[model samples]
Target: SIWCLKSKNVPTSGCTFYTRHFLCFSVDSPSRQDDEHKLIARYTTRLPLTLILHIINFDANKQKRELIAQLESKNREILAEIKRLRAEHDAVCQPSPEKGSTNPTLLAELRLLRQRKDELEQRMSSLQESRRELMVQLEGLMKLLKDEEQRQAVSSYPFLGNTETVGFSPY
Candidate 1:
């Protein structure tokens, strides 16, 4: 039989109740004769135990997905920026002997383009570093998620302890 502790103002009479964690309850009947009867009590706390864990898990999953998307977008943007920078650098590095025919304005424009190219290269390098850091964080979060899932799965099953051990290997 299942009983909810919050149904009454106080615990029901003749019931020995002990709270375990948040949701689980350990009940023992004072009378030995009641041993045959198994009573399961679920105490509703401010928050259900598993629900909170699941909510946290949901938030972590959402954060992980968002981070992954951000990382991918950043990676693409950084790649494009790097490619653009390289093209600009190549153009700047090319020897232009048109200095004789070029006007003063054209010379200033070329100088500004060269400076802009340098700035873009620096920006690209910084973005690449940020991407690397984000990737490391993503990997760590993924590992944490895997570990949490494994822990949940292990908790769902009863611990068989040493009884489940099979043949031993001598190594």
Candidate 2:
């Protein structure tokens, strides 16, 4: 009879049932072993399934908050810069007290300020688009996690009876 790891029928003492079909290999050198350890540590999920899911949810939330805060900060900085540029441009455009005409040097500086304002505006547009895309992606991921959690809840308790009223459903 085929035995599962959880089955009581399997012997407990040094029973190869858990490892029967698996092959064990060793690294050829200490460096290789260290590399293997690093790889495993990097890729392995050490927490239980539920905890892992919770951590993922928490991480998603944290990332969204951080993203918003970062974007807002950038937006504020860009706006302030644009405002400063506009003020400088206006000051430069004002008639010189003595010359009563736009100085060539002042005109050149105004051009540079306008160019910087345009660049900042373009950067703002790009940041807004990027934020929109990221929010959409995060929303999609949260939806998937919600669906998975619902599925898990249903599977974990068969007696729950899949129904919307009970807030649990099985697919």
Candidate 3:
């Protein structure tokens, strides 16, 4: 929904609904029109601040969730890749006893495969480290998301999460 704007290239239609609502009023009775205008003005002044804040917070929460999901998916893919790499490395590094006995070139090829296997192991270690770091970051972000959600829930009571130091406590 955020990707597609309803008003494309229409240079900032400032509050289209309010504009339409404003246009519908009758000007035949000047006093009543003035009262209606005042009411609409009050609504215009008060609505956007709270509404926009809520929308912003909600959007931010959704984006964080999306990022976490993407990271989790990538982590899973990396795990699968690591598994494949391990299998390939094992196959290459552990040649059968009978296979390399007669052929000198096979011995040479086995040496090269072992080197490639070492490189693959190194790469796998790095990916594993990266996965660990990503998991930590994901956990921290999830905690933050939960805290933010709780804060929003009890926003009416601003002091809910705070500790009261009443009647002089010794630290």
Candidate 4:
């Protein structure tokens, strides 16, 4: 069984774990170093422990499925917007009955529509750039996810030291 300080017979009532830059494991140990059993490393990012558990269960297939779903949804929206813009462009391009009339208002409307088209084109370009960056990020995450899956598989047996990758490596 486990041991604690409240009494030689008393075991840890319970424990809680959290994640930041590194995982933190707090137990009810009444050791001399820490009478309260509280041990927190240097502060860093505050990623919840629940998210870590989710990452623990991820597989390569799941990643692919989620990426595909996102792309499908994004493509549908883009297609719809492109269709709408094309209709607007066509309307502006159409020849009016007053072809010889020098109407300032018509010219202004045409200019405004052209400006809208330029804005749409710029947005599309940025979206494409964002997609490329996301793909790169996804690739890096996949490698880390695969490694985590392997570690979970290996820990089927008892671990000698801390199973948590919290401290520095020996090598």
- Model 1 ranges off by over 4 Å: 1-102, 160-171
The 10 consecutive residues of candidate 1 with the worst lDDT sum are 35-44
TM-score against native, each model: 0.36, 0.38, 0.35, 0.33
Task: By lDDT, rank the candidates, best first.
Answer: 2, 3, 1, 4
Q: Which stretches of candidate 2 lie above 4 Å from their native place?
A: 1-93, 96-102, 161-171
Better lDDT candidate (1, 3): 3
lDDT by residue (tens digit), candidate 3, 1-171: 011111222212333442223333343555655765566566556556878689889999999999999999999999999999999999767867775686789888779999999999999999999999999999999999988876675565655535344443221
How many angstroms is residue 64 displaced in model 2 relative to the true structure, after the best TM-score fit?
68
Tens-place lDDT digits, model 4, residues 30-126: 3634533332221112446766567766765688889999999999999999999999898767757685256778778879999999999999999
How accurate locally, in lDDT, is each candidate?
A: 0.65, 0.69, 0.68, 0.62
TM-score of 1: 0.36
Give each model's clash number: 0, 0, 0, 0
Q: Pick the candidate with the highest lDDT.
A: 2
Q: Model 2, range 1-171, lDDT digits (tens) per residue? A: 221121222224333555344222343444656655554554444436787788899999999999999999999999999999999898756666764444678668779999999999999999999999999999999999998998788778878754777775455
Instruction: State how far residue 25 of model 1 sits from its true place (Å).
Output: 99
